[model samples]
Target: MRPDYPLKTDRLVLRPFEEHDLDDLHAYRSDPEVCRYLYTHCATLEDSADRLTKTLTMSELTEEGQWLVLAAYLPEAGRVIGDVVLKWISEKHRQGEIGYVFNPEFQGRGLAREAAEEMLRIGFEDMKLHRIEAQCDPRNEPSWGLMERLGMRREAHFRQNEVFKGEWGDLYIYAMLDEEYARAS
Candidate 1:
């Protein structure tokens, strides 16, 4: 589904990534700490530019395997602080997934949660999804903590699931169903 642009929360704007967001996208994506748990390593400016170019095409989700990625823009800061993503994983099963990454400068402010919650809303309310889930490295406390705060129950913990950063890594999966979302709302 193509979301109405500029999905607004109390303190941030969730919109599609743009050509102009390169610098801001690089700001956080270039940080080693931010990229530690992510699949990609710290990105160079050119890398961020390449990523932004691809992100430009991910603004809408019209079919399975597509991703809808939005920029988490803080107007007062006059820049994009992070991004939120929803993947249309399975249309027949009505399943989707949510994910996010924000500048450390913007952490501890609930902005990531605010942006991610909107993705959940779009998944369950707008897209009529049956289930939505999020997965993160088990050691990423802040990420899992935010999932708990959003009322997503811990669904699984896979030990040494894959090679990450050249070592085995554990994964934590959290999820919420449409009925669960209705109750939480």
Candidate 2:
């Protein structure tokens, strides 16, 4: 199993989803700007609640492909500003996947990266993952750039391989192996 939640970075607290986080979570998940690269369109309040409800049951995943979603809490702001997700993709392969979303209001800040770096530490050091990968829309520069900043290499760029939000979208995959992470650390 992975480490317990509330994983902290210098300026952010990454905690498991809670019953009361609906409003703060919805604020960003519902924003077109924030959901641009996400599979679903902007969320409704009910959609946010349903999403959070699913995450609440996912503090840890004993099975492959199960995901754990954590809220990115900003203490100074006293509210949730985003979320990070880590999926146990293949225990046999010791592989996992990571994803994230943040309010546009918080985009310029490095809070998302701060939270994501901690997730990497947990997946690599605590969970003993051999590799962690990430996929993002190629047009989402901020998203893929953040992955690069985390020391992951651009492993692939599939051309217009899938439709997202009713439109054709390209994809970029970034990944880092455990040995690479160890050397970087």
Candidate 3:
């Protein structure tokens, strides 16, 4: 069952992952800087390959809180620089959660935001989601800042919420409701 994908933006195409993305995926996924906030650490080549293969099967959300992962493709550069994950947390609640990762080289280019904005559109306008939220390590200024810049309000700052990479890490939750999205537009 292929998930409908290839969502596009001005500078990106959010499509399904592919075997060809192995090198690029490993390049970033294996970087400590990139995996700092993620649950897992730097991945080996086999790990990256396995991860990519798993992503290829998850192109759409499921009823049981599964993620619909999309590859962030830069057509001009002709490469996969990152990926986006939109998890369907609750169909009854119409709630969703989003996450993203991009190559460090593309950090300041606003590509993630652009791609994320499109995902927001997909959640709100297409999927009929009532709420969309994002959570990140409070130390990850870039991630939380990007969420705020996307018009999501800071809902909570949980202190020492989880033991991440050994030590407890604080978390920040950002969200935008459907009505809020409507008001923003």
Candidate 1, residues 147-166, lDDT tens digits: the string is 99999999999999899999
Candidate 3, poorest ten consecutive residues by summed lDDT: 1-10
Which pairs of residues collide in model 2? none
By TM-score, who's the top model here?
Answer: 1
Per-candidate total of colliding backbone pairs: 0, 0, 0
Model 2: lDDT to the true structure = 0.89
Best candidate per lDDT, number? Answer: 1
Model 2 per-residue lDDT tens digits across residues 65-149:
8997888999999999999888889999999998899988988788888988887887898788999999999999999999999
- lDDT, residue 39, model 2: 90
Instruction: Report the lDDT tens digits of candidate 3 across residue range 92-160.
Output: 999999899999988899999998888788888878899999999999999998998999999999999
Q: How well does each candidate superpose onto the true structure, as a TM-score?
A: 0.99, 0.96, 0.95
| Clash list (residue pairs), candidate 1 | none
Q: Give the TM-score comparing model 2 with the true structure, all chains together.
A: 0.96
lDDT of 2 at 161: 90
Model 2: runs farther than 4 Å from truth?
none
Candidates' lDDT values, in order? Answer: 0.95, 0.89, 0.88
Runs off by more than 4 Å, candidate 1: none
